[model samples]
Target: MSDKLTKQSIEETFRELSNWGRWGEEDEVGTLNNVRPEDIVAAAGLIRRGKVFGLGVPLDQPLQSVPHKRWNTIHTFMQDGADVATGMFEGRLQYADDAINLPTHSSTHWDALAHVFNDGRMYNGHDARRFGSKGFPVNGIEKMANRMVGRGVLLDVARFKGVDSLEDEYAITNAELDACAAAQGVEIRAGDFVLIRTGYQERFWSRGDWAGHTTGMAPGLHFESCYWLKEKDVAAVAADNYAVEARPAEGEGFSYPWHGVVIPAMGLTMGEMFYLRELAADCAQDGVYEFFFCAPPLNLPGGSGSPINPQAIK
Candidate 1:
């Protein structure tokens, strides 16, 4: 087997990028340890004009175009005016109640450290078998809820390249990342929640092209860009694409190699399918890409991931 596919080489890659034992033997939050107390204070200080942007797509909309096993969000009304009219509630107070059942990753969401595995192992070298029908016993999404608030930096790569959307399967290299940051006049700092805008979400919004945006080729971070994130000590990295990395897997006989390294090896949480159109526009207009960001995942114990409505305040 080639070095890229060989077991020994993959192990070496894990060792090189792993954040295991960084905080402790029993650590679950992974790179979130980088977000110190001072980091939160600094992120809060970035709030100026009080402009807030919600970086999540509506979950009510059905995404039937993506050729995937995951189903769209299904919202059901448990109690409504009809029930009140039917005298279901004897009390004078009338209320509407509803429930939703959907995949945890059905929309904009954060993937926990246990969301991916490598060689039957999870983040911090936990056994992948620990996660089953009961959900992740360790490295659950609940462990990350408190550390989700931090400094946010937007790297608008599509705007930097003068394109509305990058071509399909376009891999954004570290060089481009650096160039985009430089052009935006923002420096990527440790413990910052870095949001990359590839303009992929805009395609669906403008052309109603869900098939092309979801199942077709998409642009995103290059496989090697995980090293760049490691070097910067970023707390979390998100993108306006289905997957955070470029589609049509760069590695042969492998799918989402970036997920393998970042989630299992590096223990880095990733946000996918985020809505960054409004935030990117504001960043470009004001020339201010730094903001106070917060996105607390649901305190779902044993969950491998959770949907989030991330907010960016500037």
Candidate 2:
């Protein structure tokens, strides 16, 4: 065969063997967009200047279902020869602390990519390699670091319903999210860290059996909603509930399918149990949803998740 014919034959043979004709190649999704790296850095500056708002719950607050072992502590002691000076320390200095066992399945926590799997794969096509002596790759809290300084938009769902709180076990739907944003005059943007306040943050601790009283997104998170947010390129989706997705995903017979969709397929992160009472109050007073938001997770390698202190600046 001529040189050109030989090349064409090879290409055709490879395509036939690989079934390339039936496959659609698309661009892989990344974590930086509507909120750029520079944007997050700038937002950090605003937070330092105190021009932002805080949206995280106090670490010491009894907002989680941590085992009793993990509670932090302080100790004071003096150097042997330094006038017996007293110093302070916290956390279980000598023993392992387990009090803050990340709910991994409950309210107000970030789900690592290892947290779920769809078609048997984790984020960035990481497979069983995600699990090891340490844990899942990109599935732990470490991958969620430096998440501050995105354009955050709030969806005040409760306010739209004229109620301070939604019914227990309430699941937020795509329509509600859209309506809430519309009421607040905010537009969803790519790379925006979306914050949905179900007004449950206010009742935390006060509610008997703290975990039981919480609300969540309703079962059906409309695939279209996930598609929309993914298309917009959000870094993460957050809410005031424990799980970012509603319980009992549509016909899936399980809760928090949003985790599967956002994390693995879309490579998006989910933030839950965010404190929004103060942030909501400020937004209500200011009548705006655009703010500089920042969240830096504790750097704990191989940790399933980390305690986050996220803030939002106007």
Candidate 3:
């Protein structure tokens, strides 16, 4: 497109890296099409330790607030009774139901192909303006509700580089990703859900430094890494930070140009703000990088994204 992420790089990259019709004209699952039956069986074989790691941040908590335009969820709980132990029939049988007003992309969530657009087109050249307002008619998250079952590989870039974390706003290049994979002795294969940890969550969430970190910069992938993802045929890629790519890009451009290419053009799903501390710790402890990764979003049709409770079983 624009030759290595310079000016108008997003425009050209969108065209070059596109998976617009790779799966057919009506394809919706996009890169998730990489996962096959055998891949699931192979992922099951990795569950020898019976250890489970929660890969989602806790919702309705203090750390829920993020910068930019996304708003935190408002959770409201209701019980049949007026108060605890004050239920009808002497507080005996009590039940509670909760309703939540949530923004689909707020917290730990997977971005659907409809999340971005390029040249007024969505995945498979779907017109963005017409369908987007009518509710993401083509490649909404529902298409991937049943496709996210497979193996997950964690590449601890921070730990591999012998640093507590990458420098704030550092743009991680493709070479760094390869070096991390090589250092871990893990061979990334097709249909693998790759998790790139920046040590951001562990650092920011712990010290209540959300203002310093969330308000402005983040450390993540460079826009050029999209080509590497295409080459690998990776089912999906995620990170512990927002937008997967480093914020405040090097050249003058939109906020998240990588997203414009990866989601709308390439039809690839992306995850963000996953809680990977414990998972990375376990991986480093056992020197095992592959595990059964599963995270299914709500079957809400037209849902742009959803808060997920992804699990990594080792």
Q: Rank the candidates by TM-score, best first.
A: 1, 3, 2
Candidate with the greatest TM-score versus the true structure: 1
What would you estimate as the lDDT of candidate 3? Answer: 0.83
Ranked candidates (lDDT, high to low): 1, 3, 2
User: Residue 259's C-alpha lDDT in candidate 1?
Assistant: 84
- Ranking 1 against 3 by TM-score, winner: 1
> Which candidate model has the greater TM-score, 2 or 3?
3
Task: For each candidate, give its TM-score against the true structure.
Answer: 0.95, 0.69, 0.93
lDDT measured at residue 13 in model 1 versus the true structure, 0 to 100:
69
Q: Residue 78 in candidate 1 has what lDDT?
A: 86
Q: In angstroms, give how far residue 178 of model 2 lies from its true place.
A: 2.3
> What is the clash count for each candidate, in the order shown?
0, 24, 1
Residues 186-219, model 3: lDDT tens digits = 9889899999999877787677655544556778
In model 2, the worst 10-residue window by lDDT is 19-28
Model 3 TM: 0.93
Model 3 misses residue 241 by how many Å? 0.5
Q: Candidate 3: misplaced stretches above 4 Å?
A: 1-7, 63-68, 80-91, 132-134, 250-253
Residue 218 error for model 3, in Å?
A: 0.9
